[model samples]
Target: MNYENKSFSIKSWAEDDRPREKLLLKGKSALSDAELIAILIGSGSRSESAVDLSKRILNSIDNNINKLGKLSVLDLQKFKGIGEAKAISIITAIELGRRRRLEGALELSKIASSQEVFNIMQPIIGELQHEEFWIIYLNNSNKVLLKEQSSKGGLTGTLVDVRLVFKKAIELFSTGIILCHNHPSGKLQPSNADKLITSKLKSAGDTLDIKVLDHLIITENAYFSFADENLM
Candidate 1:
């Protein structure tokens, strides 16, 4: 029970008691948060095992992973054995976990209206500092077949290739397509360039027999819909 004087290594422990072996035998979900962090950190200072050091680090944040995520490398270095590499390992793991949660939470398969499209795509692109053009390809039931980034550009504008948009629609056998892009300036009003592109894409969609559902100009707080404005 006196751990301060012992320089324990995880590999010296029983196989079932080791973080890596336990994970392989019982699955990652069976490991505690500190155990996972132990695997990332790999080693500890002369006085502790990696798991003990990890537990101390986690306890310093009161087991709040959110607070731990906000920690810089310098902040993590306050822990006796956590160096820059170990700090980056913990930070990268936290980031990947955050993105995985977003992937699960952001599913909107059905495209019912411009509002629904806005709800689905807004969280992904609305607050961006640059322009990004996205296409939502839909099946006959208006269920989304796929969503893809068609183009990315500077703060002012993005160049969306009409041919590339329709090509993806054809490949997916999509019956309807929704066009979307963000305005970094937070302006909901569509510009002349916006109207021109909408007209051009609508015309192309008509020839291919794929319905152009709408073109949406999105901002963090609001959006302008070409279909709602009778521009489509």
Candidate 2:
């Protein structure tokens, strides 16, 4: 009954309650977020189970996986049971998931609506900590020809080179383009600077005969569309 030195390892749990065993018995989809993350870390400290440690980590971020993904290795290492290797494992898994989403988004070849543009660009820039200006070039039929990052800057804003944007459009024979950028602050409202850049790009597109199809202010879970609001 000397409980002070007792171990609370995952191996001590019932097979059904163990993360790895449960994953093998049930399915990957059956596991909770903590269970999945426990499997990534593989083990826990002598006094806690992996799942328990994972729950504490998740609790710190209010169980927001997007917020979890934003954490750096040093950030994760601050957890009691997490070290450099385990932190790297978590970061790697999150990055792979992000890339998978990007691949899925790219499968949509045609852009028919503002929603489609959001679907395509959100995975690329939505959860970023800083700002990035992007352009989606489209052929005459609205099929995507290319998507490129136009600029990168701090949390406030990024500069878009209007001339370079059209230069690429002309080179690709793109007749239409969509402008997209992320607000790390999660604000959907277009700032005065946002409106100014949209107007600049729209006017430049007009002179070049390359239509500005839409301008999207992307956030983690939502977007603001200038075209949808009659601001185009």
Candidate 3:
């Protein structure tokens, strides 16, 4: 054992200061979101501290942890020294945290009203740069069955997969679903394609005994609910 060779590993912080060690000693409640992220990031670039980078990221979103998770991969790339691999690592970690949070609360049928949909969606919706379609499957009692991602796409937008959407409904034994997507354009108004696709999905739902409750278009600061305005 060459004792002199152990000087320059990434874990320069003392055991008390190490995020994981602190968590072990003090429990998870002792760690802030940035501290947790610093643990994930492991180390910083030459001049920046991992905690500082995490703080900068959090501050960019007005100190909202949930909001930062939704930031686009491209948007994250804007930070200096964050290359593609690091960007993916950051995005994937946030996504896993979200899914973990949703694991116990993904009851579809219990949720009602566009506001409920908005609340569940704000995290995923806020960070998107392009369009993404999510299907909120609800049981006969309107309790959430599951939240499944239907599709993702570019400026032209996601193509709704009617067959796959129904497949998930069948798996969850859902009686209804809510269609949700984001408008990167910041205009909550549904596009012509948006309208056309909604009509198609609604018609399909009718045939399959699955109801189409609403289609919500969320923006950076606003949202539109089809059911709220009787669009569906």
Ranked by TM-score, the better of candidates 1 and 3 is 3
TM-score of 3: 0.59
C-alpha TM-scores of all predictions:
0.58, 0.96, 0.59
Q: Choose 2 or 3, whichever is better by TM-score.
A: 2
Q: Per-residue lDDT tens digits of candidate 1, residues 181-213?
A: 999998989888888888899999999999999
Local accuracy of candidate 3 as per-residue lDDT tens digits, 135-157: 99888888876777899988558
Off by over 4 Å in 2: none
Model 1: residue 212 alpha-carbon error in angstroms: 0.5
lDDT of 1 at 37: 93
Off by over 4 Å in 3: 1-109
**Local distance difference test, per candidate?**
0.87, 0.94, 0.81
Model 1 Cα shift for residue 230 (angstroms): 1.9
When 1 and 2 are scored with TM-score, the better candidate is 2
Candidate 1: give the clashing pairs. none
Please identify model 1 stretches exceeding 4 Å from their true place: 1-105
Better of 2 and 3 by lDDT: 2
